[model samples]
Target: MTSGLLKKNLVCRIILICTFLYLIPPQTIAAELHLALADSTCAPMKEAGLAFTRETGIDLQYSCKSSGLLARGIQAGIIQADFFLSANANWMNSVVDNGLIDRQQVRPLLSNDLIIVTRADSAIKIQKLADLTLPEVTSIIIGEPSRAPFGRYAKQALQKSGLWDELKPKIISKKKISLAVADLAKAEEGTAAILYRTGLADFMRLQFTIPASASEPIEYYAAPLKTMANHKEKAMFLAFIAGDHFNKIFSAVGFSVIHSINRAPEKSVKASH
Candidate 1:
C-alpha cells in the first residue's frame, strides 16, 4: 500500500477509537461509590467506608453536612450520591417524598442522644435543663434548626421543657453541629451547647442528658438513591453497612445500632419543597 494511504487509514482508526471512548457511559468506567452523610456520622461512616474499600476493593467518595442541607441538595439535583446516611428521619422522608430515594429501601441504622455540654474548665454549673435559664449562663450554642437535625432536636427539647422562651435570647445558632462545638470550645465561661452524645471530645464536659421524652427519638436512616439502585458496588456497600463490623465502628463512637428486625415504623414528615 502507498505510504500516504497507510497514514490516512491510521488517522481514521484513531478518530473512530476516540469517538467510541467518548460514547462510553460514565458509570461503566467509574469504580467509586459516593456517600452523602450527616456531619455527626463523619467519624464512623468514614471508617466504615475505608473498611468497605479494603474488603471489596471498591473506592468511595463521601460528602458530610447537616442532613437537612444534604437532603435539599439531593432534592435540587445539585448532589449525586449512591447512598445517603441521614441524621434524622424527617430529612430522609423529605428525599423519599421527592423521589430522590426509594422509600422501601430506607433502613433505620443508628440512634443518638442529645446532651448539654460546656468546656471542661468552665465555672458554670448546669445540673438540668432549668439551669440554662440562670443569670450566669451567658450563651447557648446549637445547630441551625432549618439545616441541622441536632438543632431541631435541641429546639424541641427546650420547648418541651418550657425553657425555649427564656433561652431563646441567649441561643447562638450555627450551620452545623461541628461549628457549634467549635464555638462552645472558644466561648466564655458561661457558654454551653447542645450536641450529640457521640464523638464528644475530652475537652467538653457533659452537664445533662436531655430526656428522651423531651424530644422525638433521634434516629439515623440509610437510603440508597434511586439512580444507583442497580449498582453492584452499592450493594456491596449496603451489605457492609449492615454487617457487624460497621455496627461496631458506629457503636464505638457512642451510636446505638438499630437492627433491621428492630426498626420501628418511622413517622413521615411533610415534604418542604
Candidate 2:
C-alpha cells in the first residue's frame, strides 16, 4: 500500500479504538452511608440497605450490634456513625443528650412488636402473660432489659399487664433477642435456658401471640448524626427509608409495616427537620 494510504488506515484504527472506549460506561462512585444497627444479621436493615443501593446508588457501611451497645458507643464517644437506626428511642435519646447527634434530625422510623415465643414441643400452653407466672413452668426466656429494647419493652409490657413482678425471677435473660429465643428450647454453655417470644415470625416455635393489647408497642427510631457532611444526601436517604421504597422491603421481610396497627402498632416512624 502507498505510505499515504497506510497513514489513513492507522488513523481509522485509532478512531475506532477511541469510539469503543467512549462507549464503555464509566465507573460510578457510590456514596457511603455509615449506619449503626442493632437488629439481627441479614435482617430488615440489611434488606433495606440492598434496596437503597439499588434505588439511590448509595453504598451502605452498616455496623450491626445490640441497641444497648450502640447506645453505649455514642455515650462513650466510640462510634462515628453517619446514620443511627436503633430498636428504640431511649438509645437515640441518649445520643441526643450527648449533643453529638442532630436532635432535630432524629425521628421514629419503624417498630416491632414484643411477642411471646416458646418451644414448638413444649406441652405447657401459654395463651396469656399470666400463664408465665404458673409455678409448674420452670423457666421463661426473655431479653435482657438493660440492653435489648425488645427485652425492655417485654418487661414494660409485662409490668403493664401486672405480670413483671411474678415473672422476673423465673426468667432466663439473654443479651440478644434472638439469643433469648434460641435459648427457650435449647441449652447453651451448660446453662439451662428456656427462651420465649411474643410475635416473631417463627410460628412453629412460638407458643402463641400474647397480643399487642397485653404490652406497650415497641418503638424504633433513626437519627442522622453530625458525621454526615452531606446533609442533602442524608435527607434523601432518610426519605427513602420512610417512604414506600424502604417500607415495602421491610414489609416483605416478615416485618409488619410501621403504620400497621391491626398486625402491629408500628408508627410510620419518621423525623424530618
Candidate 3:
C-alpha cells in the first residue's frame, strides 16, 4: 500500500509539471529576436528596444552597420536577422529583389536632413557649400558612397552644386557616416563632414544645411524578414514602434517620423510567411 501511494504521488507531480510548461507563453521560451539596423538608427532603436523588452518580456539583439553592408550580409546569408531597418529605399529594395523580405510589407519609418558640420572650436568658418573649397579647409570627410546612403547623398549634392570636381582633392571617404563624424571630431581645425542633422555630438556644430533639391530625399524603411519564425512577437514589436511612444523617442533624437498616405496601418503589419 505504501509503494502504491508513492507511485501515485510521483505521477501527479509529473502531470502538474507538464501542465505548467504548457501554460507558459511561447515567447517566454523562444530565443531573443534579432534586428539588423543602419548605424544612424541605433540611438532611438536602442531605447525603443529596451522598452519593448520590458513590456513583452522578449529580449532583443541588434546588428548595426551601414545599410549596404547589412543588406549584403542578409543576401549572403551571413547575417541572420528577424527584422531590418534600412537608411534608404535603395538598400531595402535590394533585399526585396533578393526575395529576403516582401516588398509589400516594407514601410517608411523616419526622415532626416543632410547638413555640413565642423568641430565647434574649429577656426574654419563655412557658411555655405562653396566655403568647403576655401584654402583653410584641409579635408572634408564623407561616408563612402558605395556603402552609406548619406555618402551617396553627399556626393549627389556636391555634383548637383558643381562642387564635386573642385572638392575632389580633399574628400576623405569613410565606410560609415558615424565614422566620418568621428573622424571630423578628432581631425585638425580644417576638417568638416556632411552628415545627418540628427545626433551630432555636443562638440560638433552645423556649418550649413544641404538643400533638398541637391540630393535624393533621405528616408528610412523597415521590414521583417520573410523567414522569421516569431511572427506574433515581431508584429507586437512593429506595432510598438509605430505607436506614439516610439514616435516621441525618435523625435527627441531629431528624427522626423514619417506619416505617408501609403504607410502601413500603425496597429500592425501582417508578415508574409
Candidate 4:
C-alpha cells in the first residue's frame, strides 16, 4: 500500500511539471528587438538606444552595416530588422523596392555634410574642397560610392569642382567612414580624405568643409520593417525617434534635424537607387 502511494505521488509531480512547462511561453523571456543602422552613426544610436531602453525597458539589438549591405540584407530577407535607419535615401529606396518596409512608416530624420580631413600630424593644408588636389596630397580616402552615401556625396562634390577625374585615381574606397578615417591615420605621407561631418567629431585635423549648398544635402531616413514581430515596441521607438529627445541626440552627433516627422522636404536633392 505504501509503494502504491509513492508511485501515485510521483505521477502527480510529473503531471504538475508538465503543466507548468505548458503554461509558460517560450518567448516570454526578455529579448532585444533587432535594429539595422548605418555603420557611421553607431555612436549616436548607442547613446539613443540606452536612453530609449531606460525609458521603455525594451532592449535594442543593433546591426550596424553600410547602407548598401543593410539594404541588400533587407532585400534578400537575410536581416529581419524591426527598424531600418539608413544614411541616404537611395539605399532606403532599395529596401523599399523590395517591399520590406511600409511606405507610410518611412520619414527623413536628419541631414549631414561632407568634410575634408587629414591626419592630425599631416602637413597637408586644404583651405577648400578644390585644395584636395594639391601636389602634397597623394592618397585620398573616401567610402565606396556604390554602397556608402558619404562616398556618393564626396564624389558629387568632387565632380562639381571638376576634380573627379584628377582625384579619382587617388581616392581609395573604404567600406566604412570609420575605416576610411583609420586608413587616413595609417596612410603614407601626403594622404588625405573626404568624410561626413558626423565622422569629423571623433577625428582631428579638419582641413575644410564642403558648404551645404555646394554638396547635395545628405538626408538620413528611418522606417519600420513590415516583417516586424513587435509592432507596438517598434512604434514606441519610432515615436521616440520623431520626438525632441532624438533631435538632441542627432544634434549631439553633428546631424541637422529635419523636424518633419512624416516626410522629407520636397526641395531636398533625391538620389537614385
Candidate 5:
C-alpha cells in the first residue's frame, strides 16, 4: 500500500511538470523596435505599428516629436531609434550629414499640406493668406520656422504670397504644429493660426489649405539607423511601410502616399525683404 501510494504521488508530480511546460512560451519574444516619427503621423503610425506587430509578432515602440527636434536629438546622440521619419527633407539631410543615418536607405514616404485655421467663434475674418496682414487680426500662431517643418512651409507660403514681412510681427511662434493647433482653440479673439491640414478635422473655421505650389510640399522620409542593433527588424519595419498596406494607413490620416519624390533641389525659402 505504501509503495502504491508513493507511485501515485510521483505520477501527479510528473503531470504537474508537464502542464507547466505546456504553458511556457516556446521562444522568448523579441523586444520592441524603436521608431521615431513626426508628431503629425503619430495616430496612423501607432495604428500601423499595432497591425505590423499582429502580422509579424515584432512590436514597435514609437517616439513622436517635431522633425527638427528629432534631427537635433539624433545629432546630439540623445535619441537612439531604429527608424526615423521626418516631416521635411532638410531634417533628414541633417541626420545624414551628422553620419547618424545611411542616405542609401532613406526614401520619401508621405506628404502633407499647410492650412490656415481659426476658432469657430473667431470675430476676425480671413479670405486668404493676405487677410492675416490686416490690422484687425491681433495675433497669428505658427510653428517657429527654425524648428518646425510646418512652420517653414507656412513661412514659405506667406513669402510666396508676399505676406511674410507684413505678417511677421503678428506671428506667434509655437515649437510644434500640435501646440499651435491646440493654442488656436483657446486664443483670444481676433487671432488666427496656420498648421498642418491633417490635424484640422475637429477644428472649426478652416480658412483654406495652402496649395502645394504655394508652399513646398511637406515631404516625409523614413530610414533605418546604421547603428541600430536590430538591423533585421528595422529592415522589416521599413519594408512594411513601403508596401501598399501602410499607404492605406497614411491616407486614412490625411497623408498622401507618393511613389515619386521628385522635386527641385531644396533651397532656403528666404523671407521677402
Candidate 6:
C-alpha cells in the first residue's frame, strides 16, 4: 500500500477504536487486542476469534496470507501489521532476522500436523503418506516454502518422509494457505495439496495422519513486527492467542499450541504427519 493509504488505515483504525470506546461504557473498554493472523482459512484462528470476543472485551482485527507472502510483505515494507502469527517458524525468524521483531516479544504460539488434501469428489483412495507420489495425482499444491512457515514445515515433512526429492518438481507452490485451499477446492480434476490440518478442517473428505514415527512436529510462532504501531494492544492479543482459552479452540480445530519456546536440546520429534 502507498504511504498515504497506510496512514489512512491507521487513522481509520484509531477512529474505530475511539468510536468503540465511546459506545461501550468506560468500565467495559478494558483494552484492545489487535491481531494479524496468517489467514482466516486457519480454523484454529477463526474459532478462537469467537471465544476471544467473548472472554476478553478486547477487539481483534487480523489479516491473513501464506506465511511466505506475509514475510515478503513485512520484509518489503508493503503490508504493516501487529502481532503476526505464522504457520511456520521460518517466516517468523526471517522477520526477526531483519530486525522487524524484538527478540523479547516473539513466541512460539502453536504447532500443526501436515496433511495431503484433495477435493471432496476425488476417487483416488489415499491411505498412506507415500500415496501422494502416485502418478494418478495430477498436481500438488502448497504454500511457497520460502515465504510461508507452514510451507517450510510442509517441505521439511516431505524431506523427512522421503517424498521431497520425488515430488519437488510436481508441487504447485502458492503464497497463501487460503489460496492453497482454494486450489484444492477447485481440484475437480482431483489435484492434491499439502497444508496445515486447520487449513483443511472445513472439508469433510480430507484425510490426515499423526504418525508415531515421521517428520518433526512443525512448530509455529507469532511475533510483533516492528511496524506494529499499537504496542499494548499487540501484547494483549499475543497473550490471548497463547492463553488457555485460545488453546481450547486450537485443540478443537486440530492444532497444538506450543505455548512458549524451549531453548533446550531439540529432541527426536515425530513430526505430526
Best by lDDT: 3
Task: Pull out the clashing pairs in model 2.
Answer: 108-269, 115-197, 115-198, 115-199, 116-197, 116-198, 117-197, 184-194, 184-195, 258-266
1 or 2, greater by TM-score = 1
Note the Cα lDDT for every prediction shown. 0.85, 0.65, 0.86, 0.82, 0.80, 0.68
Q: Which ten residues in a row have the lowest lDDT in candidate 4?
A: 264-273
- The number of clashing residue pairs in model 2 is 10
Across 31-62, the per-residue lDDT of candidate 3 in tens digits comes to: 58899999899878889988888888888999
Q: Could you tell me which residue pairs clash in candidate 5?
A: none
C-alpha TM-score for every candidate? 0.88, 0.74, 0.87, 0.88, 0.82, 0.72
Q: State residue 166's C-alpha deviation in candidate 2, in Å.
A: 2.7
Residue-level lDDT of model 6, residues 1-273, one tens digit each, is: 699999999999999998987798654556554455676335566677777767666666666776666777777877767667766555666777788887566666666677777776777667777888778887778778776656776777778888889987778888777778777776756587777777764553665563624655476666677777666665556667657887787777777777564332122221221
Candidate 2 lDDT tens digits, 85-174: 777777777787777776666665565555555555555666767777766567766678898777776777778888778876777777
Task: Give me the runs in candidate 5 sitting further than 4 Å from their true place.
Answer: 1-27, 260-273
Using lDDT as the measure, name the better of candidate 1 and candidate 5: 1
| lDDT per residue as tens, model 1, 96-145 | 88888867778778889999999999888889999999999998999898
Tell me how candidate 2 scores on lDDT.
0.65
- When sorted by lDDT, best at the front, the candidate numbers are 3, 1, 4, 5, 6, 2
lDDT of 4 by residue, 1-273 (tens): 999999999999999999998998755556577889998878888998899988887899988888998899878878778888899878887787778876666788878878888878888899997788789999899989998888988888888889999988888998878788778777877988888888874446888888877666688888888888886787688788878888898898789988776564343323444
By the lDDT metric, which is better: model 4 or model 5? Answer: 4
List candidate 1 segments past 4 Å from native: 1-30, 261-273
Residue-by-residue lDDT tens digits, candidate 5, 1-273: 999999999999999999998898744546578888888888899988888998878878888889899889878878878888888888888888788887766777788888888888877778877788778888889988988888888889999999899887898998887788788878887888888878785755888777889977678877778888775676677678877788898888788987633332233311110
Output the lDDT of residue 124, model 6.
69
lDDT of 2 at 236: 73
